[model samples]
Target: MLFFSIYNQKGVPLLYYSLQHYLSLAGSLIFIPLVIVPAMGGTDGDTATVISTMLLISGITTILHSYFGTRLPLVQGSSFVYLAPVLVIMNSREYRNLAENKFKDIMKELQGAIIVGAIFQSVLGCSGLMSLLLRLINPIVVAPTIATVGLAFLSYGFPQASSCVEISIPQILLLLIFTLYLRGVSFSGHRIFQVYAVPLSVAVVWAYAFFLTDGGAYDYKGCNPDIPSSNILSDACREHAFTMKHCRTDASSAWRTAAWVRVPYPLQWGIPTFHLKTSIIMIIVSMIASVDSVGTYHSASLLVISRPPTPGIVSRGIAMEGFCSILAGLWGTGSGSTTLTENVHTIDITKVASRRAVELGALLLILFSFFGKVGALLASIPQALAVSVLCFIWALIVALGLSTLQYGQTSTFRNITIVGLSLFFSLSIPAYFQQYQPDSSFILPSYLVPYAAASNGPVHTGSKEVDFAINGLLSMNMVVAFSVAFILDNTVPGTRQERGVYVWSNVLDLVNDPTLVADFSLPRKVALFFGWAKCIGA
Candidate 1:
């Protein structure tokens, strides 16, 4: 039955080509732990167990979707972008201080929103709304947004890479040397040898840290003390500590610090609830997520497809993405989205675009997710080893961005301006937020009174309401500025001198063959002009 199901759908031979494709697809799995674990941090038994189980189920769903839905070879995993926001939310005192039952209630609410957003995505896909939206939003706008994301993330990468304490000057030199050695070996027809260098280097570093170094100082565990029992109950705890007794004997701690400290023998599951404030925040998150997903899909498609994807394919992919997120919410995991540039690079190198192969890879991921020991084992892998791997992954991510830029028509002044501005905003805003508001208690757009109240507790009080109102007014002003820019750019006629020879040629082309220029709508034309204006203005 399984064989027939696999063979009949694509009308391809099952054994011959399928196996090779599967292997190629499976190769991409090498990136999962390397990329995900560092950002996620080491999970103790409880969270680890829950996350692992969720991973397996999600992996299975992803595999099934790849096989039955799109048949595009794409590996699905926990998205990295959501990590920053989620960490902030989870760490918030407001989330933590809620009475034991109430905290769980809030979790349900947040999860519910995620599920709803995801389902909306799937609905958009089925109804072809996503495709319509894509067409309406000028690619020029998207190009700048996408370029901004890369530039923004580049700023993030520097801080993140620097945070890897194990990554010393010596370590970087070692990584460079090994990378070059692998390149040389590949040229000399020693492909197998080349393949081993990265993994081998990581293993060596880990072994050195474990045995030669003074008790693995490079690892997070080595530096931080065990979770305090009293601290667990302090309304600031976001993670539950796992001890030998908790995992092996299933003993409850005497202190009982956290409300959810005791592990239920049979896992408890619940539906998500909703809150108005959280919903508003989620809506913002969804918009950002949508932009990011679209950009990633376009970039990947440019690399893989000979022509632009059909609207149907794009919609289906978006719908599947939404479906995946809904499932993730249900399973008590963070949000999921399309794999970003790093994994895309992995796919390109592996040359495995077979959906079935990706499905098998998902199966592997699901298996890894279910077994608590597997996650624990991975966590056990020394920090030095993880850093060694990340050193390579981070470099690869930067390279992917640079490579994508090569596909642009020209690295012109307008392109540079867009890239510069986008990078600046993404990096600067986030940095300012982090530096000024380390407490995580404050609401965004810090000028409002209701926001001040919202920052204080779960329910909004008088002052908080006032803060919220003020913040809303300020936000409106910003929106108006953007609206003005949009309107003026579209309605204002260009001066005759401003319309150069190149502009005249384009105009002639549009007039000569209206059908050929049908897709170039007014908004898009205006956006192109604005890009030039920004370049000159800058």
Candidate 2:
């Protein structure tokens, strides 16, 4: 066995083991900011809460998943795939109303939605619903859904990059160079940099950004102690280092004056308030997250274990993700968890797939989260740096989406039509809604928003004004792409072999290997109760 294997004891040094854990933590730290969006005119404490909460949940979830869930080396963290919908719900008309709680009310409702939505996700995994769901999905549906996830978030990355182009552009270029070219290049034949590539590249770019922005003293008030404060809390004094100066002074002055070692517990924000419409939206996000996690499991298993994961582990991973998402809501992180692609890359680069190393990283993250200053320190990273990180990360995401095309017979017209139209409309509809809001009142209902034909089309124009209002939402790229791909793939008939259904179904059958399911399964009655013990394909 390799010295790094969790199942073996091959005598790796303690310091080396610790360094592995540190790299894993660094791999996940960048992801925290992706999930931590402050409210407009919001305070630094608010940002801190977001940062801290994400850290705590991610750390705990990683530990839990390593032990109780997949038992793989996957690191759990804030999911960008789930971000678009939560932002939509946060910006919804009904959610904006707050008597005094302001953004706290927003956090509460988000927490509530996540908690409730997670229940549905858990059911899908624990009750064998995922098996049923997969029977309906093929490469046509999978490719579009996965691809649209990256596409849907395109609006997120570019704007942030453009917001501070001078610093962002250089940062993006630097990060791309480091990860794409410098990656796996041996350092004195020791390969130190290869193992710590993500974090190290981030450190270099961040230092450069810090120098360029001069620690955000130009437009920031809090950075200069001589200047008076801005009353609004979440507002950053400086825009670099995640506006840490702003967070401490304006956002969470109370925290600045408060004690250290503030451990995060459940409901740190407040009781979650579920909204019927908003919860419905989050439920959809949850389902999308489920699919994304399943894909991550399969991909990670193939990379780490030289084969795809059996169906048992896939369902188990999904269930654990849902269960942990409920914890995220209780902890007030506002969104659920998904596997970090970066960490998987880290495993490949380092050639260390030990579960214990990941678990140790989780423990260290949990320890780091107690020092709220750590989150603040991370929060202070420049937006330019953030945009740079997003650019590199999103490129990988887009490539991952495209990778799904390999599963289908891409040369066939049927395959091309399914992939092309779904992808085309997915990008187009969301773009249309963003650019032009129709004035007609024939808009889609809250539940049917994801099912709308097209914003500009003549689906239902009885009330043109309503159509104008809802067009923007109904035309979300993911919703359109997934719905289109799903319907077409199912209704438009082709042979199982031609459609690649046979190959897909064959994967599901791998779950039927009694030894595969039994090898790491929970004891006796518990596994059966959760429906995780059965071989679905058999």
Which candidate achieves the best lDDT against the true structure? 2
CA RMSD of each candidate after superposition: 10.9, 6.3
Quality of model 2 by C-alpha lDDT: 0.63
Model 1 TM-score on a 0 to 1 scale: 0.62
Q: In candidate 2, what residue range of length 10 has the lowest lDDT sum?
A: 444-453
lDDT of 2 by residue, 1-538 (tens): 2224655543454335545645644534545343445432235555665677777788899988887677788888877766666666555444333345667777887788888888988888777677567667766777787777767656566665565565667766766666667766786554655566557777876666555445543444444432234323434633343443322222234346333667888887778887665666677778877777767776678777666665556667777888899998898876787777667656666666777767666777788788877766666565545655666666667777777777668788888899899999988877656543323324422322332322343335576544523453455676678788889988888767557652223433544456544554445324433345333311
The per-prediction tally of clashing pairs is 15, 32
* Per-residue lDDT of model 1, residues 139-195, tens digit only: 223443443333333433333334334433335555677657554555433343233
User: Any runs in candidate 1 off by more than 4 Å, and if so which?
Assistant: 1-43, 96-110, 136-181, 187-202, 213-270, 295-305, 382-403, 431-538
Model 2 / residue 39 / CA error / Å: 3.5
Give the top-scoring candidate (TM-score).
2
**Counting only residues 3 or more apart in sequence or on different chains, how many pairs clash (N, Cα, C under 3 Å) in candidate 2?**
32
In model 2, which regions exceed 4 Å deviation?
Answer: 1-36, 94-100, 188-195, 213-259, 435-473, 501-508, 511-531, 534-538
Task: Provide the global lDDT of candidate 1 against the true structure.
Answer: 0.43
